[model samples]
Target: MVGLTLLALFIRLNAQDGILLYPDSYQFLLVIRGLAESIPLDAAMGAGGDAWSAPFYRLGYPILAFPLHLVIADPETAAKALSLAAGTAAVPVVYVLARLALRSRVAAIGAGLVTALSFSLANWSNFVMPEATAVFLLTLSMLLAYLTGRAGRAVAVAAALTTALLVFVRFEMLLVVPSLVAFIALGAGQERSKVLPAVRLYLTSLAGLIAAFALALWWAFGGVMSGLSVDPTSLFQAHVIESTTAAHQGAPALSGLRDFLDREPLLILAGGMGLALALRRRPDQRWALWLQMLPLLLLYGLRNDMRYFALLVPALAYASGLALDEGWAALRRLATSQRAAPALAVSATASLVVLTIVFWQTDLTN
Candidate 1:
């Protein structure tokens, strides 16, 4: 875990120097600077002028990066550092998530390695945007939510808090709430006697925390939604309906998903197989995991931005790990049963060659 995290950090650090800064990156930098300099939220929101709405509404990333900004004295560098740190931290979190979901150390380590080396995720981590931070928090929230069944009430509360923080980082992540509820409820159902109590406690705590957080945001910023956009219909139209319409006109609805798959074809293919296997082998967790991934999948199906798919990396890494483990086991069995050592060696070499070509053809940073 430590080695994988360091590898991820090193890669991100190297990737940071040459990365292009987008409009959103500057918005995040403005938010970080505002927070570090003790500027009021409203003033900070207006700091970017009328061109870009202040990203101050997504307070979680700025709050985390502000201290680093004060110390580093460079908002962009500080934001990048925070992103790199969160991305690196997610490697081990991915490992733990994979372990919990797959029950195999080999699979967990594979997941960790995949996360450490994931090109799309690494690219996002080098930016001054909130994607990396959101991904980290989302993965952590998933882990905590998954543990609620075995770890009990405190973990459930922690999951809710983490989810609240996640929403603060990326309002789109609010979609995760229903998925989390499904995860907790399905997990609790395993404890037949305690199912209702567990579900009630988890749901009640999540609601209370969300309500308190929303009120606090409203009190502090005069609004709970992102920026000055308080109208739910406007927010929905801007983020969802407009994107969907544009996606349909510009390209296929699944273009974003297709582009994501193009970048990591091997992992996606393996992960799909692994998920199918898991559905059969881990009946208890199948729906929970499916629900966790469904919302994002549906959203991306209607959008053409591949960057948003970074949120799915942790889950895909875990499934890829499972597939890799199963493949290795099958190979060993084949080699042993058929006494085809030479054939097995050639096949392994050919497989590696194909993977090398695929990776070599794909860009690790965009």
Candidate 2:
């Protein structure tokens, strides 16, 4: 299923209809090209501008594309090729994360199936965006972090570094780190003495991430997110500029989000309910989910909706798996104990397919 998804999305990516998702799509690609050319990473060269402040988003993708850019003068195609690969990898990463979370092979495959066919997700591959790569990197990092927490001390150090790298890929991933912290703390038997040390370690890892981001941004662009001179205290105003500018560069954020939900209400609702159910299973998980959703909510509530929510499709997919799991359990209990096997399986498969179709079809391909 993961292979099929990779082929499906890669074919679509290769056959893109020349639909540039946003005006700024070229900025990142161009910046990578310029970086390859050894150009200064300043707005003069496209780094410190509103068009692109952080050119190293998912640097793993661009690094893979470095050879491509060297060979192909048209950096857009090279950069997008990298995006496509990362997007393809995201399918398996989603499966891995879902499997880790749910501890079910069938559920994991089912979740990846949903993620792979999500048109919204596949679309990211066709563009010069970091969401696909970010999701893949962050999800993989999340999985490793959780597993490390389960394993104990030696793995925890590596987990810290990997989790930090994940943050460097996408800033929003900071929200989910709590799950790793919890896993680690819990692994330490949650003894009172262990909790404080775990907290200190997590904070230290987070600080390392922030420092890494700052150093990378400074070295690559000579500024922080373009070195915009916004006051730290004026976070609201600064965000207003960023949000408004981002909308102007593409569609109004909220408007597009509203359209997405309107078109795929059932799927979105199912995903949300699944997330709620998963969170309800544990208090710490609830806090982690809350942290994950809170920033998106705050940002979208204040401005246009982000078109890149599909990039987080794996997160959505895991939640959807939970929803499907619950519904399947309920239906099985409702039907005759041993007679409705075929019907139950058919019903479950149908719901999952419908969700995949909804996600694929409703993508804002423009």
Candidate 3:
């Protein structure tokens, strides 16, 4: 885990030419600077000037980055630093999730290693945006949700809190609510009697936390809903209904998936095969994880933004690791029967490594 994390950090560090800032990055930087300097929310919202909102409503990322900003005295560097830290930290979280899903240390290690080398994850870590942090929190939420069955009440509470925090980071993350509920409802494994109570407990805790968070925001800002400038109905119509209609009309439905496959062919192929195997094997938590990924996949598939697919990197890497592990196991079984199997396995593994390197280089150039 330690090695994988360091490798992830190293890749992110070398992948950039200093801090990469975007239009959205400036919004976050303004908020981080405002928070660090004790500027009020309303003042911070207008800090950007020219009527550009400072993302005060999704304040979680800037709030977390403020301490770094205070020390570094550079909001851009601080924001990127926070992103790098979160992205690197996700390595172990991905490994843990893989371990829970596959129940194999080798597969878990493979997942961590693949995540470390992921170009998309590395690219996002280089940017001063909320994506890296959101991905980390999302992965953590998935882990906590997976743990609820084994750890019971405490884990359920933790999952709820994490889910609430995730939503705070990215309001769109509220889409995860149904998936989380499904996970909790079916988390108790074969303990059919415990499922309902566990789901109820999680829902109650999540509701309370969300309410408390809203109340705190309202008290601090003088109002909660007033800070948000977006109209929910319009946003839904534009982002959801319109996007879907457009996709069906002319835009390719699977463009986003195709973009990812072109960039990370081996990883995508392996992940697809692994997911197919998981479906056949029907692992205990397979459906929970799949449910969690469904909404994101659908949304991004419609949007066709490859960058948004970064959110799915860890999960895909986990599935890739599972596929690789299964392949190795099959080869081992063949090796016991045929003398040439060992040579074939070695050749196949070498080819995969070389191909992965080629893909990584191509992605870096792009």
In the order shown, the candidates' Cα RMSDs to the true structure are 3.7, 4.7, 4.1
**Top TM-score prediction, candidate number:** 1
lDDT of 3 at 298: 74
TM-score: the better of candidates 2 and 3: 3
Q: Point to the candidate with the largest lDDT.
A: 1
Model 1, span 123-187: residue lDDT tens: 88988888888889988887787677556675778888888888777777887776666556554
Candidate 2 residue spans exceeding 4 A from truth: 1-15, 44-73, 179-202, 216-240, 244-246, 249-253, 263-267, 279-285, 331-366
Compose the digit string of candidate 3's lDDT tens values, residues 1-366. Answer: 788888788787777774447666777776677667755444224323523243554567877788899899788889888989998898999888778756788788778877877767777888887778888888787778767865677688899888888777776678777766655554566766776666778889988998788677556644322434444354334334433433333657676667776776655676777777767764654666576568778767755556667777766786777877787687677777756667686868877985667456435646
Clashing pairs in 3: none
Off by over 4 Å in 1: 40-57, 181-190, 221-238, 241-254, 340-343, 354-366
Q: What is the TM-score of each candidate against the true structure?
A: 0.84, 0.76, 0.83
Residue-level lDDT of model 2, residues 1-366, one tens digit each, is 557466557555554776665555656775667567865444434424443244443344554565788987788877777777777777777677657666666657666766666655566667777666676666566566555555544465566666666665555566667655655554444444655555566567668766775566457644423533323244334434554444544556466577556554544766787778866754444543455555655555434444546544655676676676676666767676675787777787977977676555645453
Q: By descending TM-score, how would the candidates be arranged?
A: 1, 3, 2
Question: lDDT: which is higher, 2 or 3?
Answer: 3
Q: What's the distance in Å from true for residue 88, model 3?
A: 0.4
Q: Candidate 2 — worst ten consecutive residues by lDDT sum?
A: 223-232
lDDT of 3 at 292: 56
Model 3 regions lying over 4 Å from their true place: 40-54, 181-187, 221-258, 283-285, 339-343, 346-355, 358-365
* lDDT values, one for every candidate: 0.71, 0.60, 0.71
